[model samples]
Target: METGIRDIVLKWTAVVVAATWIIGCGGSATKPSPPPPAFPKAPAKKPSVTSPKKATQRPYKVGRNWYQPIPHAHGFTQKGIASWYGKKFHGRKTSNGEIYNMYAVTAAHKTLPMDTWVRVKNLDNNRSIDVRINDRGPFVRGRIIDLSYSAAKRIDMVGAGTARVEIFALGAAASGEPSSKRPPAFVPVDYNKGNFTFQVGAFKERKNAERLRQALDRRYKNAHISEYDSPDGLFFRVRVGRITDLAQAEAYEQILIEDGFNQAFIVAE
Candidate 1:
């Protein structure tokens, strides 16, 4: 009976040891604890940057002359002979790419920046006009400013062609408060009262005159070809718009110049 009891105890001990070994091997094969529950990676960061500002002023040249426009022209002042340009340059482009308008209060300067507003006083007559500088010119020596035909008329320089004048720069229009006053109205002249017209082009060849007339007709009203017998020879004149007064004629001339007819001028009927 004692031998049988001892054998039963040994069997139970062997069973317990085998069960412990099985549990240890199963836990070791548990997929390495699921790789510690993998997490997503973060994105990389980028650096910031900035750019430099552009320059506002630049130097330029025309013909034999070099010019450096003033970047800032406020408070600038000058005194010299101011000449007037009419029908000859009436319908042309200004230095600033604007259509030249002789009727508008505008002028041209050599060194003053474009779009500058200036007060011009005719020293001879004490007449003053406010003009915007929209072109570069008076390339002629001894001349300081080139006034538009209308500007010249304001200062009574139309008969003289030029006048001694004083000019004061008032800065850019954008930099100052806008004027509330309306611009001067263009007074129309009665066709029956006077004989005036804008001669846009003159050609010795009738065919050339006809071509210009056709071009002008497409862009302007009342464009026509008129024949003129000059001492040199017969010439064809391409005229546009009849006017009754010199002021009205000059205004039409300005329109032609802006249209690329640089030789356009006023003529009496």
Candidate 2:
């Protein structure tokens, strides 16, 4: 009886150990589904880029005064005292980037656009000169334009330093009109023996002066060569279009400048 009891206990013990072993092997084979396949991390995002802004055209102030550059200077005119500059500023870069030549027929204005053509009339003596606006200046109160040395000399204002002047804007066409509208044709007037004339060129050689006179004669009603005896030496001067009226001479002076005779200046006979 004892032996049978012992055999029954051993059989039950063997069955419990086999069942535990089977459960352990099944848990090891499953492996927790390989940690759910480890989903790939999302990619990092990048930044965006942009462009720069443009400059604005706005009115600005300078010193104790305010200045607004006229959007369009066409037909703009002003009258005030005119002064001049010379050797001190020569060969320096102008406000418009041009090398300032005090001898050139150019001027500076507080507000006129660069390259503007202006006829400046000296109210004191009724003398006039044509100048191209290429710089900005005369910041002093009551001053309007700053004339180049040669331009001021033409109007007989060099000795006076400053003079009351009338500035007329030219080549500024009326809005909607062609910029190239033909200027009025020059009228031929009776040559006054004592009238003032424009000297387009002066040459030591008479033949050279004659060649310029011939060129001017074709375009002008009257062109002549005159002998000038100066302290420097004798020179042949080519003069064109005699006029007694200073205003008329100014008009002709502008025409001569536009025709590329930039050195042309008024000479009183």
Candidate 3:
């Protein structure tokens, strides 16, 4: 009976030892440790922001027509009908590739170099305002400048659809120069030297251009034909006179206009 008791005790002790070994080894015995508490992921970084780029001024196209802007605003002055545009072109892209702002003190000129600062005086009321040229326009035959709504209002020309005005170029606002509020003294364009010509006409046919040029050469002396390869095709332009000074060119242009060359306009060669 005592030997049977000893064997039963030994079997119990063996069972206890096996269970202790399994627990110490960290086997599937201890509720499988809660999969190492998950760590929260770090927040993602945001992209950096940068400022918009400034636009550049260059030759541009409008309504299937190409316009070559002058190089500078040296001594530019003119007297003609001035008009204003507002909501219709407020957000459109200007000739200089800038967004149009109707309320800004800006203006459009057919050929004045972009970024030129011009002072406009309303002859009717003597009201004046300084505006920067940022686009091209006033496309109308007698219109010489197109002002922004705010610019027109400053000159008291908003009530009138158009106003007779005198414009004087102040050139690009440079350091040590007078500010727009106080424009520098008006300097008349009296260039003693420059290659200036008058573009009288452009023709698709070289023969027609040559004939006109030959006729002009008899009286104008320096009349010639220039060929241009436009996007539409090739064109021959008839130009007359090679003069020095814009003043002389302007006077000559008037004479040509009276002589039936109504389409003549001054151009820097």
Candidate 4:
């Protein structure tokens, strides 16, 4: 006990060292697991493909004495004995490439376009009539307007066979004739010039023109064709619309170009 310190330290050191080693080796280390991957949401839808809401169209209802536009008729000037036509000539062809009817309350005026509307006031009885101008007549000179057979009876001019009257233009009027001419017909500066159509090309075949028409109908709703079968033969021609806005019309020209219509241009409707 007095002289051996090394022997006593070595005996206790082994037990402490062995215990530390056993305690440290008893525990095991664990590795961490990875997280799940995140998924992305789809993109938003665009607006171009959506369909537009349709508009409601209004119906026109009229009774008696309505003069609708008949392109066959135009021009007027007259002073004559107005005689009416009826019964036998009803539904017959008039001079202006249109059918005539006695019941329609129509009249005739020389040099005036067919399908014109005239207000005939009887000079004798002062009676009045609204007649559709379809036929042509009054071969005699010094007579300006001629009445359809029915028009003359309505105004009591048939019995006399002669009446003084006036012709009026309604809706869109032709040149020299108007409701009233306060604003000059010719405006040097065209502030309100409207868009119109033109025929850039023509074809003898209707099928070709129709195919072009279908491709343009959506962009140019007014786009159409006119058929003229001259003494020669049937001819089909493609025509763009009478669109009021020229700039808007230009936009359609681009569409036409994309659709393979090259030479397309604007024309008067």
Model 2 regions lying over 4 Å from their true place = 1-61, 172-269
- In the range 65-173, model 4's lDDT, one tens digit per residue, is 1111212222323344565555445546665545554444666654444444566777666778776555565444345566655567677765565777655543223
lDDT of candidate 4 at residue 181, scale 0 to 100: 20
Q: Order the candidates by TM-score, highest first.
A: 3, 1, 2, 4
Q: Please say which candidate is ahead in TM-score: 1 or 2.
A: 1
Question: Between the candidate structures 2 and 3, which one is better when assessed by TM-score?
Answer: 3
lDDT-sorted candidate list, best first? 3, 1, 2, 4
Highest lDDT against the true fold, candidate: 3
TM-scores, each model vs. reference: 0.45, 0.42, 0.63, 0.35
RMSD, model 4, all Cα superposed? Answer: 45.1
lDDT of 2 by residue, 143-197 (tens): 8889988789899987777899999876432334322222233223323233656
Q: Between candidates 1 and 4, name the one with more favorable lDDT.
A: 1
Greater-TM-score candidate between 3 and 4: 3
Off by over 4 Å in 1: 1-56, 175-269
- Per-residue accuracy of model 3 over 1-269 as CA lDDT, tens digit each: 11121111121111111101011123365585655322222225312212212323333445544455654567778999998887667667776666676767889897887667888999999989989877778766678899987899899887666899999987664545432223454444444457876566677899988887776665556678888776677888776666677666666656544554444556677
Any runs in candidate 4 off by more than 4 Å, and if so which? 1-78, 171-269
Model 3: weakest 10-residue lDDT segment is: 14-23
